[model samples]
Target: MNDELRLKIEEYLGGIMSTSEATLFEQEMARNSELKEEVILQKQINHHLRDDKLNAEIPENEYTRRIRTYVKSDEAAHIKQVLKGVEKDYKERVKKPRRKNLMVAAILIGALLLSGIGYWYTSQATPQELYASYYSTNDLPSVIQRGDKDSKLAKGAVAFQENNFELALNYFSEYIESTSELDPFVYIYIGVINMEQGNIASANMALDNAIDSNTLDSSRGLWFKALTYLKAGDTENAGLFLKKLVESTTNFNYSKAKDLLEKL
Candidate 1:
């Protein structure tokens, strides 16, 4: 847990560094999902595990009550007899239809409950997957909208990263004109390149599009939008965008948004 590496990753995420640096950081991040998840979780825990944050400030009696809350209900202690082998041992007519129905119903109920819980757990995935799922789920307007233009946006991102802002701007503009299905992130990066090159109007437009463009889900996409707005000095919209991201797993953005909110 070197502070230097931590800061380096954060800076890379903020788009202030070179692509080679970011690629290295991303390679490390992608080496293991658990390691990357742990990295984010540590950042979150460091922010929230503060003296004044939660447990430390609670009264002894309240804390004791919180502990008691985990005690199981009476139903958890109560045991139910399971008819495990009854179904297999009997033919349809050998057992009463009523008995068969009850067993089948119970098994289905258990399965449904288990499936529901599993689905809920899956839905609570990390934000990056959330964004990816969001992108993939939309079907991307299947028309291709225009031929070969999508690749130009990708090229634009690379050019922008290389600081060829004018060339990046042209590619982005061409890509933008070709299709409406562009990933919102491209708009952010394209806008940022424009911003850095002092094309305030286009920069504002690009970031605004990133913020306003339709997407399948609201992961930290709102965070990107908020950052773009902030960079554009549109604090009003930025604050509003950040407000929607408060309860998400996007704690890095949540804390950053809190800072922006305070300043506003």
Candidate 2:
């Protein structure tokens, strides 16, 4: 590769490439296996170069200067010799070698524990994915009073029970417009319907209304609101609600909330 292309690759690996340039480069990589391999190799080298803990006993500037000088030089054997000398010097200078060994051991142990924890975390589904796994219309409040005989509210409840979310939502909307005393459960139903349809923001707004109305068990509203945030991958907000649910013994799903909080 030309010097300009080499420098561009370096810049890209360093994350300093402009958005448009990065987009173009990614498009190029899609078509070029050799370019992709070169980029991956550069990234691996960059990772080692960025690790400050690599040669902790060496003075930062002196070690950096040695590395840069060796890399820039054309003499490959000289580079190996210099690196060996650097390592030997660090080992010789550490008079308390046993203490250094203990410190290194401690670091290694901590790193292993962290790596295990990270693997466990990443191996599990994300909050959004977990929400999908746990979610069910059965969790929603059952239609207790199907309203006046053959009423829109009754029809909406039937549709909701039948899993026809859109039709249920439409019926509920018409009922809300027709009635003066709006049932808070209607808002809860609407919110849940929106959530099932993946309309996160709308679900949240309706759940908020349910909470503010102070009708229908507001704890259920809070629980569903938290689930809405969880489904949308807003774990911060979801955690807040989950914490609240855990604190409230009266919430129906307190145990489930506690379980979800532990995952977060």
Candidate 1 weakest lDDT stretch, 10 residues? 134-143
Off by over 4 Å in 2: 1-123, 144-146
Tens digit per residue, CA lDDT, model 2, 1-264: 678877889988778999999999999999988887788777767767888455333335987999977777878677688689879867775655786567655654654454445435542679878788667666776555655747887788889888898888889899889988857678888998888787987998788777767654677888898888888888767767776665546675888877776676
Residue ranges of candidate 1 with Cα displaced over 4 Å: 1-150, 198-201, 216-225, 228-237, 247-252
Candidate 1 residue-wise lDDT, 230-252, digit = tens: 55555556555555554343433
Measured against the true structure, the TM-scores of the candidates, in listed sequence, are: 0.35, 0.51
What is the Å distance of residue 47 in model 2 from its true position?
A: 38
How does model 2 fare in lDDT?
0.76
Which has the greatest TM-score?
A: 2
